[model samples]
Target chain A: GIQVEQSPPDLILQEGANSTLRCNFSDSVNNLQWFHQNPWGQLINLFYIPSGTKQNGRLSATTVATERYSLLYISSSQTTDSGVYFCAVLGGTYKYIFGTGTRLKVLA
Target chain B: SQTIHQWPATLVQPVGSPLSLECTVEGTSNPNLYWYRQAAGRGLQLLFYSVGIGQISSEVPQNLSASRPQDRQFILSSKKLLLSDSGFYLCAWSEIAGSREQYFGPGTRLTVT
Candidate 1:
């Protein structure tokens, strides 16, 4: 089983601020996704990048599979962005392993 | 686009009670279904997963069982619930033997008092 580790377990930012979240996996991954679990607890998929970079609105993610790590960038953060961001990965095995998550708080 | 549906957005039950949570996926057939539990302020825990109807694999040893009666229907059940079972349960699906990007359904928040 592969282990996933996320950096900055907790983060606080002012509105319009920028931040970076990192995820490192212990093994190669065939699948990787970034999810934003809002205050209401719905896991909203942000990106499904196994490799390369993808951008959606103010958020962007890059996965360097060769390096076994991924980075999620949040720019111009809004109050609505306040919640937990999770990184989940499907390694060589079919199952997924999730990081503990990076809790973000945006102060307006 | 594929859509996943989970029932009973929230539930409160006493210890030792029976539990059943249902999940179904649409716009796709023979998808791989999964059941996950997320404790308060915690990450998702894989409880069980199914590749197809009548095929299930348990990830953790817990008081839970999952069944897939149809190509797109997955059910998570527990004969006797424990207080420890209280958590947010999520159901997700992906194409059969295909992609890894899973589509998740709104989770069920279970509280065992």
Candidate 2:
């Protein structure tokens, strides 16, 4: 089983601000995904970046597979972004391990 | 387009009661299905996964069990619920081709009194 750790367990930002979240895995992973669990408890897929970088609107993610780390960037944050951000990875099995998550609060 | 569904948006039951949660996927075949639990202010924990009909793999040894009687249906059951079983249960599915990205269902919020 691989270990997943997310940094900055909690974050608060003003509207239109920017922030970054990091995830570190203990070993090699064949799959990595970023998810946003909104206030309504719906887990929305953000990115499926096993490696390299990807962007969708004001959100972008970069995965350095060789370094066993990934970063998620949110620019011009909105109040709608207030929720939990999760990083999950699949390593050597069908099971996906998730980090404790980063809780974000964007104040309007 | 593939869509996952979960029923009983919320549930409240007494301790020792039997529990059953259902998940179904549409527009896909032979997809991989998974069950996860998220406790309050906590992370997601893998409970069970199925690659096909009648093929279930439990990640954690608990009172909970899962079954896949059909290709697109998954069921999570508990003979007797515990107070600790109160949490948000989610069902997810991914492609059978080994892709890691998974689409999650709306989730069910269960509370055991």
Top-DockQ structure, candidate number: 2
Error of 1 at A26 (Å): 0.7
DockQ of each: 0.79, 0.89
Question: Candidate 1 on B5-95: residue-level lDDT in tens?
Answer: 9999999999999999999999988888899999999899989999978999998998899999999999999999999999999999877
Candidate 2 C-alpha error for residue B90, in Å? 0.3
lDDT of 1 at B68: 94
Error of 2 at B7 (Å): 0.8
lDDT of each: 0.93, 0.95
Tell me the spans in candidate 2 whose CA falls farther than 4 Å from its real position.
Answer: none
TM-scores for every candidate against the unseen true structure: 0.98, 0.98
User: Which portions of model 1 show Cα errors greater than 4 Å?
Assistant: none
lDDT of 1 by residue, A15-95 (tens): 999999999999888899999999999999999999999999899999999999999999999999999999999865568
Task: Give lDDT tens digits, candidate 2, residues A1-108.
Answer: 799999999999999999999999999999999999998899999999999999999999999999999999999999999999999999776878999999999999
What shift in Å separates residue B35 of candidate 1 from its native position after superposition? 0.4
Ten contiguous residues minimizing lDDT sum, candidate 1 chain A: A89-98
Which candidate should be chosen as best, given TM-score against the real structure?
2
